[model samples]
Target: MKILLPVDGSECALRAVDHLIAHAAWYREVPEIHLLHVHPPIPIGRVQAHVGEDTLKAYYLEESQASLLAAQQKLDAAGRFHTTHIHVGQPAEIIAKMAKDLGCDLIVMGTHGRGAVAGLVMGSVANRLLHSAPCPVMLVR
Candidate 1:
């Protein structure tokens, strides 16, 4: 199975990594893993114009690296290797798109476990992924 794992470097996100590590043996074979971190697009008019494309791209790379580091460390400590993907866009949309592009059977990610009202107010990525992901989504709270 190919699993798409979205990580944000938060404590809640780490729960998803832990879940994968704890339950990996349940599968018939070791799953192929893909770790994804999505960053919001750079401001096109002001920031990009001032910073230039290369600098903005560098910033995105730096931020994405910071976000993926913890997840990478956790997976490495568990002895699971994974491919890394960094995308620039809305988190929910990017995550869903990456899952399909990677031909993944499942998307495993963390949820903040916000209440429905809170989710509505906060606009949760998990809620969006649940509705839009191409494959089944497993959320670790």
Candidate 2:
């Protein structure tokens, strides 16, 4: 099975990663893992205008790479072979899109575990992905 794992470097996100690592042995065949981090898009006009396109791109790359580091280290330590990706956009949208593009059979992600009221007001990425993702989504808090 191909699993798409999205990590934001939150304790919750790392929890999801840990869960997957522990359960990996349950599967008959080792699954292919795709690790992804989605950074919010650069502010519409100001940051891009000030930094220039190339510099803005560099900034996005740096931040996203940093966000992925903890998860990457854990995977490395476990000797798990996987591919990593970074994108700038709405996290839910990017995650759903990436799963489809990569032909992932399942999506395993972490949730921030907001209260229902807070989630309804601020919205939840995991909730959005549940509706938008083409494949099954497993959310770990």
Candidate 3:
């Protein structure tokens, strides 16, 4: 099975990883896990006025990579089979698109992310994903 797990470096996100680790053996075949971290888009006008586009892009990319690396370390320590993806966009949209593009059979992610206000207003990433995902989505609270 191809599984896409999106992490935002939150305890809730890590909980999803922990759940996956504990339940990995349930699948008949070893799953190919894709650990995804989506960096929010840089505000074009503000970024251009302060920092150049290249610098903004580089900063976002660097941060995304760091998040991915952190998640990778956790997965590695758990001895799970996986790869990492760092994207720049809305978290829910990017995760769903990635699942479609990667042919993922399932998307396992957290119900609540880092931001409390945004999650309350716009709903959580897992909530959005559950409504729009192409495949089965498992939400770890």
Full ranking by lDDT = 1, 2, 3
Candidate 1 runs further than 4 Å off = 113-123
Residue lDDT tens for model 2, 15-123? 8889889899977899999999988786777765567888888888998888889889998899888899989898889999999999999998887632233274323
Candidate lDDT (C-alpha), each? 0.86, 0.85, 0.84
lDDT tens digits by residue: candidate 1, 1-141: 999999878787888999999999988999999999888785687775578788888999998899899899999999998999999998889988899988999998888532233384333888878889999998887
User: Which pairs in model 2 have colliding backbones?
Assistant: none
Ranked candidates, highest TM-score first: 1, 2, 3
RMSD of each: 2.9, 2.8, 2.0
Relative to the unseen true structure, what is the C-alpha lDDT of residue 141 in candidate 2, on a scale of 0 to 100?
A: 63
Backbone collisions counted per model = 0, 0, 0
> 20, model 3: CA deviation in Å?
0.4
TM agreement with the true structure for every prediction = 0.91, 0.91, 0.90
Would you list the clashing residue pairs of candidate 3? none
